[model samples]
Target: MSRQRPRVLARAPGQPQALPASLHPVLRRVYAARGLAPEQLALDAARLQAPTALKQIDTASALLADAIVAQTPIVISGDYDADGATGVAVAVCGLRALGAGAVHYVVPDRFRMGYGLSPALAELAARSGAQLLITVDAGISSLEGVAHAQRLGLKVIVTDHHLPGSVLPSAEAIVNPNQPGCGFASKHLAGVGVMFYLLLATRAQLRAQNWFATRSEPNLAELLDLVAIGTVADVVRLDHNNRILVAQGLARIRAGRARPGVQALLQVAGRSAERLSATDLGFVLGPRINAAGRLEDIRSGIDCLLAADLQSALPMAQELERYNRERRAIETDMRETAELMIEDSDAAGICLFDESWHEGVVGLVASRIKERLHRPTFAFARAQEAGVLKGSGRSIAGLHLRDALAAIDAQAPGLILRYGGHAMAAGLSLAEARYEQFAQSFAALCAQWLDEDALQLQVHTDGELRGEEFSLDTARALEQGGPWGQGFPEPLFEGRFEVQSLRVLKELHVKYRLRSADGQSIEAMHFNGIEQLRERGSLHATYRLAINRWQGSESLELQLLDVLD
Candidate 1:
């Protein structure tokens, strides 16, 4: 197969640019395109919107504070993902720091109780003597589950970030920024971010009531490490507010104040805590934590994050590495098989299934397939429920996966048994026999909703860098300019380069030395495309500046994103 060059468009520079004259010109333009003024680029905790701005946060905090004073047994029910794991950790750690009595946590086993605060989960919490139930990363649409908790005599506090349905859960207090009527400045907070906000509010409420007169007030900043890990791992849009949370967390880690578990994870990944960045948090540490949830159980992940010492955290980190390795092996097999399974059909979307596929790893396979094909893709595996299959999907920029699923359900009622997710990703379940039917309906919806242009991939850039600006200083400046992720993407610059030397690396990656028009040479790499994109002459490529570190030395390198001869 030949490599396809995506259409490239450069973002327009910021207007009436108020950036400091001392700022790098290239980065000044890039930051402007992202709508960041010079002052707004500095991430501080003060930049975070007041927690009280979130709907019902005060009420939620009051309830939590009261429960703590009354010595109530609280149980945090979490979903089975990094966000849920970190949310549980933050809630437990923060609550304990606040002097809450008997704070406990339970993460649902995906194979057992499914996601969210289910009725079954509520029963389990009740058995544990939980008088107050706090849900993280889930529960906005869990009407049945919340009602069940209420029936079990548990006061449910829902702290989630997923989009809510028309009918909200009748929980005692809800603290979701996406919940209707919330005027919170940023609606893109991850589950951990919401939990952190709640902790902040709870502290203030206690302080106001003189509850901390004798006790040293817990500095909530200590929990930002988990917040940063979860926010990036969950792949939520890193808006200004979330950037503050993540930047703070990264600062803490680099200052040697990271939680023992995070430190151990850093050690396992061979990442320097002093040089940790958003990329390390998202790609390095996040994957190790997520691996436990994907291959085994998320409880171990939560336990790892909650580990109190390096000695305890190291073993858990090692266990997570094992799980991640297993997950990668399964993903490799599934991805290769799924690729061969693709036919010459003209469907607007792709749906794949295999009875042998592990449900835990289907999401990873879907992400891989979507990246390869640039199509809305879904990968399904057999569910524990008889005659049912669970499917996880990833969407391209122009399509909303969940909305497309909703459309399919609306057109052929009962076609989807259950589903929910964000614009870029979603999960759903249906009768095993309905795979073909659902696929056709989904394709039709995609065809109706997406245009020809939407199907074609496009690579947006921040324009080409001047030869003088392509130095280590410029690269490091860009690194310092971010806590970039998701919505706020790291910069990619496009330019034509003369191939100085090119070769295949380890039979997979494309390695090359390229010279710019001004005769500046730089090392570049494109992973997993050694065969598909080989070119002999000058080529236009979109790339990002990256710091190549080796044996305690650092140099500038380009990570090739795409190329056109």
Candidate 2:
């Protein structure tokens, strides 16, 4: 964690518009560090609202309408992750609300179906007698899969956010913002967001034609809770449109009107939906949604999102909580094992493989090890029956994981076998015997692609804060600004504090009630910092800040990130 902290970025890119003319020092520091200018914080309802004309959405609108008119049998294909599962639920519900009762959905099992739309999935749909296949959160690169679906007499409409390949799929309609030949601003839209907008457009077209005479349109905005969950869970950028969606969903959640599934899930995780924050979504909710893909089928994930009754959702939520627990245990065990492997192996890059490691948890182990070791790391688990190993890799910034694989794909003839993903995260399969070759080639490519600065990790703080500014109102404003996920990060402010006192929290963490050098007091805490402080045998430190909650009340807490003497 020794990366250079940029000296307070004067203009963090893409700051919100129309900020106050004279901001508080803390606000200026926080906003400026996050790439904001005073003019950028223009919090106008008009500026923040989503745009209507998203190009060719009208075509998607017309296509779905025709499908409804002809009563075409349709199936929604989704990934096993939260974004994909919620996307499937959204498409089905939104479509059914518009009178498409012939709709069904399909999700791929991670072990068998793998990721994305493929020939096997097409074959599955063909056998199901589905005529129109709409893939959500996937299918952008299914060039072969699209062709296979067409041959099987299926019309495919893909709403995905994956980076498209050079040869675009031959689908009847493709609605990915990142795909070529199509222009949709906010390239950072998540898969669920794309699906959500497509549904909105479909509804608009139906209303224009007076499709609903007696029946009123279901509150489509009600689905924003799911949309917001998926958007944040998928780790996509929260642009203007997405921020509004997230903000609206958060407001509803705080007001106790989020969906039954979300509400039930909060109860299972011992979190109150009324107190939902982006921190909860990223750390708690996202992991639960991902647990199904990590440990088992994502049916529980989809069920948790689509459950109609709060009571009906409870058992699924309980099971998901169980999965998340098991997931954490397995990830911890595997990461420890992988770290030992790295400590021994003198390799250019890290690639640890084991037949005993749970396959579902390897990606997470890879990510954890990457954070610990600060190198591009890939954790591999053998599919013993296939005589091959599947690996999920994570990398530091500056190195594109997918492009690195593409480079290896070009240089080495048949080494990688199969692969695809984005810059920071990726997946692939290769022969077990070729681990050395693959490891060497990938390491060489990473070193060539990555600079020294990319390997170091640094925390970016919004600004420093004083105890006086830490209040219920300030925290509330920050909380409202929250539900902050990727792109729009939760504000993190650092401040110097004299350690007035400290306690060993279960011997696993440190608890503190601090006072500034000027006699200002602030409640503070440092999770997992007991050992570090004990090693030094002192608590004279300064730390970063976050709000600590208790008994329906909020106060500023200095979360001791690193102990600086």
Candidate 3:
């Protein structure tokens, strides 16, 4: 065993085998752990949440209306991620439809720009003729940049979802649910979700001022397709409010009314808008959009979202697909290298120093190693810029990765030059010479918090689903109930299957068929698991269930999760 697995909380001592109304007996335990309820997930439109409940949307509306009337040259400052790009696209499309003047957007280049609104980003916006700057998916702690923009005579309206610093930027208006004193009920909104709220507010303001008396409402809700995709890709929790957004967007997609840009992305990802699902966004769309930010400029991702026609969207999606393919190649190469470095080192914690690693894909490589090795992993790569060593780290649960890095800085006083992030993922920078010290200090902190319990990898699964239960009908229902990601997970089900046969498609991958004891046989592919399955023998597995189709034929297939020999 890599590390001893945990005893997941099982159902009460002797629970009933079958569940009542709504939940299939098999999914009852899963939904219970997933923090969902039968009533909450009903597919009826009546179950959907409304945006009016969030306070201060009225203020957002007024700000948007003022910008429209004044013809203020507006600029949207976005983060360099798919969610950031989608948020920017929504703002541009919604604003132009509502009569906002000369709206332009800028995304932080991952290589040149760090993250969020910096003085450098402010300078870029200043020269763009922007009198009013509206931040999308970024700019909560841009204290210095917001001040810089203010001094340069630019009024700022911020719409973001990141945790705010002790002091917020002195913008003309700020609309972040996490901001101090905001009474928004749902704190789970993603960056794009915040942008959607701004659109809602803008509509309310336009209505109040009779801006829509003669003109139409512009069907702002139609843009939820982009919002839902970005929200899930950015790994925002799918709360009741977010689920409504995602569910509604998916409904439009199923009805064949999705935005042209969203349809284009689906085709690029080898999915159809007419068959959209929460899984498609998380696994397919998310990675492709993220690939653009990781390896190239996020503007291409945003451009795909903003593209007006399908013909125009094809090349953009193709370009993004190419970037994603290259990104995967880089990740594979770097991951293999990092694995060797870890085994070679006798160090307590993992810190792989590879100068030639691609800076853009290091974060992903760090995450992969962290999961497989069951230890925190920091993957370092050379920065294109001089005098900087870029580092990205991912941690196992119970270890506050960001806090540990902060503690390293605190202990030696300025040992770690700069860092930022949350509990699970983090990014940092230090001089090349200080890498060893940072690693040592980070190891020390982890040793304090971690115990035997924290080392084990626990997979909490909803158990034993049959092929009949995994039908497209059930899949569609499950699809409607999600925008699942970081906090809210897509469903995972376990099954006891006998390996009927296995074919080595490539030495690394196995094309296999399995039959459930219930006599449900399904075709499944275990990607890159030939060696593991060969060593482990015919297996019992816990996997994510989905309806995979081939050439117009649809049936249930397992997306491989965890397998036990």
TM-scores of the candidates in the order shown = 0.98, 0.92, 0.91
Best by TM-score: 1
**Ranking by lDDT, best first?**
1, 3, 2
Q: Model 1 TM-score?
A: 0.98
Question: lDDT of all predictions, in order shown?
Answer: 0.89, 0.75, 0.77
Pairs of residues at least 3 apart in sequence or in different chains that clash in candidate 3: none
Worst 10 residues of 3 by lDDT: 9-18
Candidate 3 regions off by >4 Å? 1-29, 43-57, 344-349, 465-483, 518-522, 534-538
Q: How large is the C-alpha RMSD of every model relative to the true structure? A: 1.4, 3.1, 3.0
Question: Candidate 1: which stretches are off by over 4 Å?
Answer: 1-4
Worst lDDT run of 10 residues, candidate 2, spans: 1-10
State the local distance difference test value for candidate 3: 0.77
Candidate 1 lDDT over residue span 1-565, tens digit each: 1223577888777653687767877778778888886667778888788998999999999999999989899999998988999999999999999999998887777877777888898888888898999999999988999999999899999999999988999999999999989999899999999999999999999999999988999889999999999999999988888999999999999999999999998888777899888988888988889898888798888898899999999999989988988988999999888877874555778899999999999999989878776778899999989999999999998898888888888888998999999899999999999999998888778888889888877878998887688999889989998888888899999999898888897888898899988899989988876655656778788899988998889988999987755
Badly placed stretches (over 4 Å) of model 2 are 1-18, 21-25, 37-55, 344-348, 470-473, 534-544
- In candidate 3, position 404 carries an lDDT of 79
